[model samples]
Target: MSADDTDFLAQRFEAHRGHLRAVAHRMLGSAAEAEDAVQEAWFRVSRSDTDRVDNLGGWLTTVVGRVCLDMLRSRKSRAEEPLDSTPHGAPPSPAHAAPADPEQDALLADSVGAALLVVLDTLTPAERLAFVLHDLFAVPYEEVAAVVDRTPAAARQLASRARRRVRGADVPEDDRVRRRRHREIVDAFLAAARNGDFEGLLDVLDPDVVVRSEAGVTTGAAAVARGASAFGSAALTARPTPVSRHALVDGAVGVAVLVDGRVERALRFAFVRDRIAVIDIVTDPERVARLDIAPV
Candidate 1:
């Protein structure tokens, strides 16, 4: 590519990095993977003869979409893990370790939530690419088909199937609403649990509340009690420690469960009115490293 062409490509890549990352992250469910996909797309775009392209933004989007789809398909064949294996219960990592740039942070904070990303993971690779490109990015079906290497009709079907999963009976509207109510319930749950107030815990918990740990490490309300009680007892027995700050996880309020300055857990809450609906406590250490947690 000529110097002018190189400069043009650089400008275009910078402009669309946020858009490309959003699409990739939605497909891959990991910020690290998404960044790699976008980098690969940029590599491809840099080598291509951009002078021949009529629309730069569209071309970049198509390349990023293709790269992300390839990653998704490769992941599916390699690992078949259940969804909801990890709950959103950990402190955010230090800001310097955050996987996304400032722009990406804003886009994710506003557009994608933790629950939505979980839903996207359930989709097949083709369906995920088609849905994200066509529905979320507003790419034309013809272009999306080209990126996914599918017939336009087939791509449409993939997107339709993915949409159905997102809008299915399993994902109730109430669950989405629960994201908004999660923070309040989490705060109340922690307070009551810390105080050993069984009545307080019962007041916040739904009659049939379920608390599942990462990879099914623990389950059910009783299990939740056992696990939480262990932590609470530690807090009471240990020397006075600084409290961790709380922040929104994909817009849902959550507590950053910290211990001795390192983020030990992230406790994301789900609520039905004033009652606790579900408490997802994510304890995946690798996943915890990606969040933007402020230091103690």
Candidate 2:
């Protein structure tokens, strides 16, 4: 291609850069890796002849999807830490990282919830690619199949499985309702404790409930209630006001305590009917970070 032709192609590629980056980010869950994937796609596209390609945008999207799929599969094979291994609250390194962009980060967090990223990490590369491209981006199954090397029907199935996992399809509709109710009970118990309402806390706790933590186990409703009151008191006196929010802990309703906008710990619960039968406190930083947490 002549200089003019090359410049024209570059402009066209630039137009699709943001979209391609979004696709790669959703697939890879890392800004750095997404940038690498988009750059690789540009390299391939610029080297190829596109004289007869009618839909340039569609063509570019598919190219990026294919690039992302390869990156995901390679990541799986390597069995290494994710490319975006910045710990939950650590600042990115200035020497090796792109300039900070809070606006873009917030947009991505809104577009793809942290919980969804956790679930996507559990999917196979093919399934993740099929779901993100076809379900999220409205790419046709024909194109999805081409990218994942599966039949259109197979590609459809891959996305279906991924969709099911993302939506917690393993849980029945009735069970889901019950889970929500459990969350409400948990929330109420926390509220009561925060306000030092012993009766309200007892109303949501099973008589034989067991509470386990790194400190030790506290059994019986009355005993647990007293402990919860003390816990709440501590939160009230802490330097920063603590916030309790419900989140999904290993696919079930649970509570997370946030201090200064970071998850300090989590409380996983087991229910006997409508009341909380067990409370397992997770304070280990690593374990807390791995929990499947999302807004309730």
Candidate 3:
């Protein structure tokens, strides 16, 4: 409240905002929710008496942990309610799946990816909070325990369970290997599709290859020809031109599209065993403005 107190809080926020956001995002899987949790934590910190707290960092972290846990618990309860209670013919689009261009996709893939977030969502709130804080952020068990209101041993157990679940799922290899394979697969797939070489594209595709679009479209290898046809048709209508053939999205290979020398689209590929396992295309027109992408 006082100038000195305000300055101290401001300094703390500057020092720890990134760390807080990382922990919250990993737990909740929503940047918007993570930001809200951080703001709520700050509000609680401001109302407290700082003089009584010896370790301000630890105190703030605990506040954030508690806030995130409370939010997760509320969400879980809603999920458990009867379906009729919550109108649900079809799920709404995920918030994170905004239409993205090449630049936006490139930037996002490095910091966060859809596959990784899906794995994180399998965890319970407590497990997510404990694991992200202790494993990802390297926060100690004792400190993390305080945030989740659990004993250190219990927090350690929660994190362990969460770690096992994540590790059990398949993860792409190191950045370098992932990128190399991604480029190889994307190039092969595109070339084959362009030439109407179904066998060529099939050869490069994994047996279970999947393609997803931000528009809620999904297709597998069995339907790849149809999917590719749709994409090709749209490409013609949109008059897409390649701005850059090779770019990295989170260290994975991506293709950039430009219209009038400005970035208009970005497509990222995921590879498995030297085959194209997944392809993500983002065509959100707004992404150009949000990412400040320059036209080729």
Q: If scored against the real structure, what TM-score would every candidate get?
A: 0.51, 0.52, 0.48
Winner by TM-score: 2
Alpha carbon deviation, residue 165, candidate 1 (Å): 1.4
Off by over 4 Å in 1: 79-99, 172-174, 178-296
Cα deviation in Å at residue 74, candidate 1? 1.2
Instruction: Please write out the lDDT profile of model 2 over residues 1-296, one tens digit for every residue.
Output: 77677678877877887778778888888777777677677677767898899999899889988888887878767875444434344322222244535676555554555566888989999999988887566588899999989999998889878876887635446556776788789878878887888899999998989987777888999999987886775632233677777776544467778889988888878666578877878787886775556666
- Model 1's lDDT to the true fold? 0.64
Model 3 stretches astray by more than 4 angstroms? 79-109, 172-296
Residue 149 Cα positional deviation in candidate 3, in Å, after optimal superposition: 2.1
* CA lDDT, candidate 2, residue 38: 72
The per-model lDDT (C-alpha) reads 0.64, 0.75, 0.63
Error of 2 at 264 (Å): 46
RMSD of each: 18.5, 18.0, 17.3
Error (Å) of candidate 2 at residue 141 is 0.7
Candidates ranked by TM-score: 2, 1, 3
Using lDDT as the yardstick, the better of models 2 and 3 is: 2
The TM-score that candidate 3 achieves is 0.48
